[model samples]
Target: MTNSKLLKLPSQRQLVDRLLHLIEFNHPFIFLSGKPGSGRGTLCESLLNGLPDTVRVVSLIGSAAMKMADVRQLLLQQVVARPLFNPQDALADSFFRMLDGKPANLLLLIERTDELPADLVGELWALCRHNDTLASPHKLAIIVCGNDVWCRSQKEALKGRAMPALELEVAPLSPPEQRIFLYEKAKELKIPTALLPKPKVEEILNGANGHPSAIMQSLEDIMTDRRPKKRQAELPVKKIAIVLALVVAGLLGLSYLPLFDGMGKEETREQPQEGALPAPIGSDALETNAASGAQASGSAVNGDQVARDWQSDAKTLPKKVESETVTTESTNYEGRRVVISDEVVEKLMTQPNVSGALPTEVVNELTGVSSAGATQKSAPATPSAAQHAQPSAPTAQAAPKAAVPVAVAAPKVALTPVSTLNKKPKNHYSIQLMGASNTQAVDSFVAEHALAGKVWVYKTRFRGSPWYVVVQGDYASSAQAKTAIRKLSPALLKGQPWPKSFAQIQKELKQ
Candidate 1:
């Protein structure tokens, strides 16, 4: 038979033999080590393929590869005849159960075994050693596959374990093996042996360093490049360079066209006009001064006597304007002062009524004026309204007379009965059930158990299904539900009800 259709690699027979031996002897622990790209994974697949269906293999890798909990879960759930228990107890119990002397075979193929923590490895080793004494009859096996670096580091940890272990190193193919590999690959691609030409095949094999994956990749590249001789053509370097230069110049022109065009349009639009006058201001004041000058000129034109008359009139006009300005200023100042005084009074009202003497400056600002006549004019014949409204003086004067009466009145109210105020009733405990299919069964069970009026049932949907059942009531403790479940014997009821927390039941119904 030709080796053309097979994966021709080094050390194939030896690895196959060792794996078979491990299976036959029921070795519980085996480690496969090799450099990356030395086909460790492929070797494991081949060995697994050769095994009988009775042997179940569980493979784990990558980030999920190291979690012992995940490993234990797979062992319990996926393996045939595996036992189940609470996770806390399942850790030790499951290992023992798998190790018991049953004839059925099991192979746990853990890839990237180096990722597992040291403590987990130690625990696993301990189980492999002591499992026979703890459980019944069956053989449990674990096969670890990883690179040489991982194997070297973990060798000490695997020592002294009861399970016989072997470390198989897979090396790269030799020159003869490379030749065989290329032949098989070429045939698989359906390429005739003569068409590959010995020199080209050998060139590919040498460049690939005899690695199967690299060699196969090169072969694929060579096969895809096959073309008819007549259509193939090669361009001179000068021609190629000219073509590339033209393409690059075109791309650069295309990139800058929009930017230069926008700048040119903006510059054209901003060109200035020939002549433009600025706007006029204060024109009304200039007009008024011009009118005054014209009036003075007209008076001179009338005659010398008229000029004297205009001079008197001009003198009176200036004085009258000054007087009018002063009167307007005085009126505005008085109005502003009154507004300021009102604001001050409002600020004083906002102040807390604390016992303190007013500051001298504040008293002066409120009562003193620029002239004494102003203050005298402001002060009233009777006390001002603010002085009459002062609360401290009146309260002090009335306190002594009111004390005894106020004290006598308080005792009368204290002597009255205190039973007039109402008290709230105590809360009653109750439960409402939601999403329950068999309400009558739950109600009857509750009534028979003397839980009537305490528990209720309601129907709802859970996870888009009409199968949701909920029971509600006052549960003194979370553990009370478990106790209730035992008494109710849910399996014997109309539907096989399971114990679930109130929060969980409510969440399911909401969904």
Candidate 2:
């Protein structure tokens, strides 16, 4: 219910989604609201464009006409199956039933409601109450769009309403969206300001302030002036050269001095001879050795350091060996221990030039494969293969699973592939994705398919409870339907599908 979707300006996807949500949920009212010049009307049109041809939008602009007679124009715009003969009849009720036999709902977008007097809004709200009628099975969602929230201001009139309106404010376009709009606008004009220097370009965008209307106005002025003024370069090359020369000469002069001679030369602090003085932790000359366990002359390092130092040396040990029993042990290659799988090693040994253990080329090739998809996953190969077997228990049991090949195939589907049957029988089939027959389910199916009335939800009650059944794609034959069902990515599907023909569905509807 909280439409907290961030919509990029000029891109109507989110706006369309929100409108679909309103329709699917049977939301009584939506004030197509926004700040002034936020492209509210344009957003409405964008949303309307995606709607099915069956869904009629009766646009009533409040500012354009005030008298009751002017609203008749809204009805005349659409091809009406039945026209109202009584002017005394309430506008909302007449609009609701005006759709006579429309399979889909009617969307009434009353624009510029801010211009309409508060009294007129009061009459409209009172009039909109009829939109929630159960008679005629008519669906009408009234949307009054304007810059201000009119209903909130007229709380007195909305007091007795059976259903309240949900206000959705269309925010101004974001900075990025504004930039895109400006660029596209400039493209239409064939100007180079859109690609102008950064500072100047940013200045132009900054002037727009993330508003579509402002972008059009500010971009015009900037586009007329194609280029930005270039500033002069000010690097002191001569001063830098003199500084570098002085520093180099000073370095050469210091190199000859005795003070610099002893610098950086390692002192050969010879270890104590057999019966000579020993350096201990208490001595001032004691120093640390990184590799061996000797922190001081004739003194061993702590046991931990001795272990770490030995581990480093062990990594450099040669791996080539004769008559080795371990076939799957990890090999220390290039200071990094690379796991050489027994299977890959066995395969390589079958080829020529593999007599001496495995050749370096073979090992590198095996390592490359081991790092790829082959070794990236382990869990899927086991469980996914098991799941596939479970789903088609009898068929899987009858066939022989090639061990390594089966494992490789299993990992691919372990996440989503599932290795289910790729083909199905062709028939007049429909995918029963969900159930609980109501307008809500139908709306959901519509939004999901964007197919409108071409595919629909059937309302039927089972066990004294209403069930809305969501189905899609009516195929001519069972095999065709099965193929269509297979096309549905297993990743997107929630559960096992029941693809049934219209004959099979008739029995369900009866039940």
Candidate 3:
């Protein structure tokens, strides 16, 4: 990645800032060619805030061996924002379908284009060349970035064929530029200057030259050395001395024996024929012989019978508990799912340890959710405070504030954003969903749903269990709130739908 400080360089600033103008007034297929480690990926991220507010940049990486189907799948994830899709149509056409009613301009950035097969590059070029006709009128622009050598080769190979009219090359940073980039990155990473010795840092800089990727690696090495890493606990000096003494004593005892010298010399007679010795039988042959002997024995066991016995035992074994999916009836506007957090995770989020991001394993452990997004993958382990108290104590006390929802209608009036909902609002009504101990699950639910109205996740400790209640769209009266819920499909109400006044919500939130 390019260090943010690289923006200070004149060439990078000019190159990135001009992308919008070049695409809008000139050509649609803009090629940004750079060698590996030239900060090509970081350049895309750096340009995000500079583009016109009307344009939304959707970035996805292209694999070296990507098929047409893989390219389609990538587009589906970025543009549609869905993890799963049925591949029935061309991805390019499906991409246009996603933008059918959306108003924003789109810039599709396919990175590592050099690694992509030539056919895919050609297809992308054609898509950009005709996006206005194929999709919305001039709503889409395409950028295909890759290594300079391969890109130049592809362009030359095409000769008089269609090429990106606004082709630009991202050159490697100069030596001084690399040092400045490293300093900026160190500051951003919060690595102290004193932790990196000048002589050693200079050695890293000289080795890295001007490559951003290399400098990042050198900086990581410096940071790692700064950490108080545990050394392999060394053996006591007495133990090491004892081992040495044993070896020396054995050698001294052997020197007094004449058989030792004779044994060492008998090597001459045996070594004369060693060169013509035959190779020993391999382990495979030994195993085959052993198996054959077992079959020939009178008490031979039947392999088929053993297999059947094992299968019978397996059939009797209890099955593992899987994560259950909570399927709510949707009006075809929502695009997210929810999992019931296991008891462990509920307890974790109920506590106060969740201030920033947690390790993924810790998240899974506390939430009782697996990587598959299942809430109850297995039962939450009972905390053993009398035994392993350290981990359980903090977990019994932590909670997160974020959760999710699907598409809902915009509110008639401006309501409080989720952040300001910490205080109980003036008495009004809202819809309460089920509570979860996992703040991550709650956060994901609201965000993935893109619930356009005011939504709040109430934090409360009920009967010692931490609960986060997700409330959507506050109304002025119980009749209006109940009326709003009744107009929806029965499938939408997975839990009991009741109108909760602000006072009631505040009571639950403050509990």
Best-fitting candidate, measured by lDDT?
Answer: 3
**Candidate 2, residue 270: CA error in Å?**
99
Error of 3 at 291 (Å): 91
Report the lDDT of model 2 for residue 48: 67
Candidate 2 or 3, higher TM-score?
A: 3
Clash count (model 1, backbone only): 17
Supply the TM-score for candidate 3: 0.40
Give the RMSD in angstroms, all C-alphas superposed, for model 3: 34.2
Model 3 segments more than 4 A misplaced = 1-3, 64-66, 76-104, 132-137, 157-165, 190-198, 226-511
Model 2 TM-score is 0.37
lDDT tens readout by residue for model 2, 1-511: 0111223444446666878777756746666666666667666666666677766777766764465555544544463655754555555556546555554467767778677645556556655565445455455666778765554554434655566667777776777776667677767666675456678668867865665666665556665754466887988999999999999999999878875555534343343447534333343223335533343334443422222222233556568665533444346544554455565567665776555586544554566643332432423567567667577666554344333332121111011111111122233577776664455545644455454544445555677887666666767777876777778756426555667776656555565
Write model 1 residue lDDT over 38-156, tens digit each, in one string: 66666677777677776677566635344667666655666645455444444456655554555546677777677664455565566566655544534567777777877766665
Candidate 1 Cα misplacement greater than 4 A, ranges? 1-10, 26-28, 62-66, 80-83, 86-91, 97-104, 115-120, 132-137, 162-164, 191-199, 221-511
Cα deviation in Å at residue 476, candidate 3? 38
What are the RMSDs of all candidates, in order? 23.7, 31.2, 34.2
Q: Give per-model TM-scores.
A: 0.39, 0.37, 0.40
